[model samples]
Target: MANENGEGEDIPVAANVLGTIGTILWCIQLVPQIWYNWRRKKTEGLPASMMLLWATCAVPLGIYLVLQNVNIPLQIQPQIFGALSYVTWGQILYYDHGYSRLKAIVVVLAASAISGGLEALFILTLRIPYRKGTTWPALFFGIIAAIMLTLGLIPPYFEIRKRHGRVIGINWFFLAIDTFGALFSLFSLAAQKSFDILGGVNYILVALLEFGIYGCHTVWRIRNRKLLREAKKSGRSVDELLEERELERQRQRELESSNGERFTGIDYDEEKSRPSTEAHSVDGGFVQEPAGWHRT
Candidate 1:
């Protein structure tokens, strides 16, 4: 039961305990991302491919959620978590490149209009045919979904990375929360006396994937730090490291030119000092005393 706060006071203790645990995990997961993004102000080296893959995974899970329709206390299956996941993704986008409130309102209106148009074309005009269980439709939409998700993740990734030159400020706490949330989800599923339903399995899988993502990201960040250090030692900056290497070629050219000049100077002096055979004969040509040359 909630205390004097008057917020959700009378729920069962199990659900509350599960929710609390899940929430802690969610915070763990989210805090790192948010902290890195905010403090380091960078998202560079974060693979857009990874995020795209994640969103791809999310799509199938969302479909599964719809297909299984598992119910739990507090609607604790994928429905609540799934929707929350989308919201979190949206927040990521906003955190990176959010618009002003008024501008966001305009964008929302515009998006609504576009969606309305599409709905009209499909539902009202009946121009689009509805097909079930077709491979072609699945392939077409699958590619489209992949492209759209990739596109959505691209901007913020670039924006944050470009801004901070690294993914420093990202929140790690959020990741922890999410990881724990998955465990709680697994527990909750086990709590479901019915083993026949797919909800628990689905949540377990989701949690596993989320944990994998966090693990990979952590390793990636560590490796990236080493890479950056190496880059700096080699006299390169994050954005222009390659360019700096190209500039080093100019240094090489200058060094080669200087060396060539020294060698050429020595060769020229040697050639000039070579005595001509005619100098021994001294015929017809007035033999001037060999010009006294003094090495300076």
Candidate 2:
């Protein structure tokens, strides 16, 4: 348990430094995502689910770091910086993509809560159990983190290799950030000779997901782009094609309007032509009693 400084199991200055490096890597991860959103002015390809889960993990970790008497520097290194990254992502989604305020807020809040819960649970169990000479919390957290990390990438996997070249909910920029962030974390881990359960595995697995799946999507996107260019070069009428798309949309709207109107069951002509049946019936099938006398 002795750290290099002979500090008995105390977090080392070196670990703090590497934690700073990890924070920097996290900030860097936001860049690609932000840039993509800015360029596209949209969060179209971004996966809300992944961001939601990851942000959830970060917020709790942030809270845990704060509670641990870990210096602000260390806490800020990941917790503050990491939370900011999620916020930045959300902002891009809102301002760039014009997502409604409610939707953006939901994503932000969910991410914060999940991150805070996980971080708190991990640290509290670590500290409290260690004081009582128990490591079960650590084991449980490890298993949970592993499961989450593995499942987190499945959506992206389907997005990439589904035989139709669909990226599904995965964003290419987000994937790139995740991959490089993992690479950076691996490097940071190697440098500081420290391995934390969540950080290291998340880094590696995310990298693999990006390279294996998202990378394929990028290739397909490029291929499609090339085909589009060739079509343009051959004067295959790309604008006209897009125009036809707009026209089709209009037609669909028209059809929907017509269908809706037909189903509404309001007929002015019938209303105008219909007699007052109640009044006609009350007029008495020709005053039957008097009519009987007249007939007789």
Candidate 3:
């Protein structure tokens, strides 16, 4: 193959093959998270900052990959990643933070526009005479993206710690898939005629972070299953145990409200004072009272 400077270079076929696999993996990496959020109808423990930073990082990454004349699949990979990340971020805002649908949509659009515009500006600026034939600009942006990716995992790590080692609201399968994708991307980078040092480091860090998350998730699941078994032994269903937990959480919120915590729009006192009503099991594994009725 011929380099951009018209010099002869041996491009490995394996590099392109691995890059294609990495591209495919990256494209679908977010699907599990998206599906998990949709099915759960919540994003409680997911970090919006992580998604936002990663999405922003992708703008520079895409520009760098394209400017370096990487394979077409690699060039397109970051765009897909950014778009999906924005969607995940929007889900967090809408479901976890209770943003209105219109507000979430506006925010996602604004972010996408800003990132895309910045990437375009960089692409144009890097095409100037002095920067045109050099790899410095691409390398600089790639390093920046790598740093952003490494830092993005910090919030999620803290979130897990704050939850007492419980991996709530995170989909382990998603993390596993993402880690594998990062591993494949590292292999792809290694097979290149000139390996991307920054990219390889970024993928390695991402894979390690994701694997750590998976480990935490496994431990959390084991703990939860043990608790569920204990509940069963006590003649209680898991749903009942979960409902108790929810009630406890609600009571804690009420206590906070009484102690001058911010208003949450719910009249906790009124709910508490309502007349007793029979609880009925619902298909979703929760207990509910009849409409116009309340539990004492």
Candidate 4:
């Protein structure tokens, strides 16, 4: 769909280099997250929906790349990227959602197959129109891909909101990789001979949202550091401090409830029992776990 006579545009060298880096980053971005989930035996604050949405995104994106006949790495990226997303999503199911190992494998494999088939079908459907000098059809797929991609990043923000402005329960390394991938891909778009509005918008949305997450992380970390110092100064463990904070938050929640009712039920403040209910549980919980200073 490059010209009315049917030709492919030349991919500029800068674009090629940048696109390759972005492709590589995205292709393997989820590995760290998957490994983190496996090592922790929990998904924690990572949202399963984000992974699935990304996996779904690969379908339309694969079709767009196929029809556009882009660079080799770019052409292959959506496929591998989506497959890895599926595997990562499966990990969430197994570790976070309590799916059996066998079930997770089965689900991931099945979803991958269905997604691959759907992508192929769309490519076949659009290939003729694209060759006949129609660009909008292929462009439509790109737009859909972009929308799906942006949607995938939104779930984490909700998790952050639920945790009261904290971006918690995700691997910092994983988030860094994803944000860089989007940023590099954006630069790659700028390097192109002609900017793809759809693609540019996608990367922009991703970068902006991820940067916001980083901002939230920064603010949360700064405040958390102060709390850590106070905890240490008072000869109270971080867990105990967290317990008190959680109890206070619970009281706030009860106060904010629409029922206009509040109840006090804290058994700590001056002192608390080991493995207290208010203590952020390493053994009993990791969801939205506070990033307190490491004791060891």
Candidate 5:
């Protein structure tokens, strides 16, 4: 990413242009998901860990890009990404984790301060080595950023792979924009005077992971379309059917976890915590249970 001149070197026009566009897209890529979370008042499908991981990665990434003296857009992308990631993470804590507004705001502010301080320290420390013509520190930060970025996209796969599950919290618009941003970043690297292998690999890995997410999105769409048709014929709204489906899955899980006991809208331990050595039937009958069933 550094030129022989190390500063004020002319970058290719195409690289500059593509980097600009990619930067713009990346800046807004998370906006849709943030807005969706605000409107939905929850963050079910979107894991807070993913956003936190991204924010964590951005610190080192920003340090690396700035130290490497990459093009202006690439230099600033991590900073903006980190800020928005904190916002999204704040929303998740507030809505999904039941944190109070004040608590969530405090947490986000603390995180931002810590990351900003860390990035500053890293950049300052790495600049000394960079000025000494030692590039390993920059490379180290780049490698760390790449690994974090790759790991950040894994949590959502666990959600989407569940039975009859759909991509619930993440917005497709956000994903589409992100994919375009990745492609543009890759193209910018291709157009650059020096190909940054770390940067190129980072972008390529994200784009490929995003392709799998898009495929997951496609499967959800197909299943949802079928359910929509069924909803019409069954005189039930899609929401109702989806809710019923989720309840059914929850019941099945509870049933399996309780060793053939039925779910009755209460916690398993609470339901079985009675001192009597009998399980109460729905019809108010007392059925004998196995010994020590109440303890577990």
Candidate 6:
């Protein structure tokens, strides 16, 4: 049966089913990351570049899907994906990079507008009949989009590697959904007898990278748990360990805050001449005498 667009290809029912599933997955894929960022009020290890590139690639990918006259579910997948990606990117800019709200909004909107304009131009140019029953221009854009999608994963891959595979600020649930969505999209393409080599490779790479990160997170968690157990055996409360970690982080933040200042105008010599406080060692290794108390 011909599609509404009069494209001669007969899309399979199974393809529509798989495509719908993939579309749903992709639609909600970034929600976890967005929610995580909101709850934590931080985007520490999330790669803004990854989100930006993926959002940009979606414009061409959406155009290609429309040109190919794929099912409506597949056609709209890239748009939703792109919208969520832009949101995620904005979060990174705002939280991690300290971008002002107005600045982040302007940047995201500008990028989105540029992408939409380019896609429109490409679609119009590609629809021109260059040969008998073949739209080489659409195919060209599709290939480029696929390559861009694959390349977008590079930033996150290095981020994970830099953390020695620890998940860090990444939302693992987002990765799982994204990987599954890519796999289902591949199946959809295969069902339609339109399996693209680049598309397949892109999905494979996404799944592999996500799984690698998952494995690394699992290992790190296991190791941390073992150390915690050891600490517990040494009569240390887990609460104490957590408190110590928090204190260390506080110290780091304080050090960063005090990096460029000299202690002002305090005359230590005159203060010492007036009175001296006795110092003593205590359980936590510090003690100080009360003000105006002299050692006798």
Which digits, one per residue and each the tens of the lDDT, describe model 5 over residues 100-170?
Answer: 99999999999999999999998887798798899988778878988998899998888788734466678
Question: How high is the lDDT of residue 259 in model 3?
Answer: 67
Model 4: per-residue lDDT, tens digit, 1-296? 11101136677878767777777888888888878888888886789999999999989888888888866667788888898899889988988798999999999999999999999988888899888988798778788888988998899989988765676558888888888888888888787778876667778888898888898867876878988799879999765888898999999887688344322223343234433232344677754422443335
Q: Which stretches of candidate 1 lie over 4 Å from their true place?
A: 1-20, 23-101, 105-170, 221-296
Output the lDDT of residue 242, model 3. 72
lDDT, candidate 6, at 249: 100
Candidate 3 collision pairs: none
Overall lDDT per candidate, in order of appearance: 0.45, 0.56, 0.77, 0.78, 0.82, 0.75
* Candidate 6 CA-lDDT value: 0.75
Better of 2 and 3 by lDDT: 3
For candidate 5, the per-residue lDDT at 35 reads 96
TM-score per candidate: 0.39, 0.55, 0.73, 0.77, 0.77, 0.71
* lDDT score for residue 97 of model 6: 96
TM-score of 3: 0.73
Model 5 clash pairs are none
- In candidate 1, what residue range of length 10 has the lowest lDDT sum? 1-10
Model number with the top TM-score: 5
Pitting candidate 1 against candidate 3, the one with the higher lDDT is 3
Q: How many residue pairs in model 6 have overlapping backbones? A: 0
Candidates arranged by lDDT, highest first: 5, 4, 3, 6, 2, 1
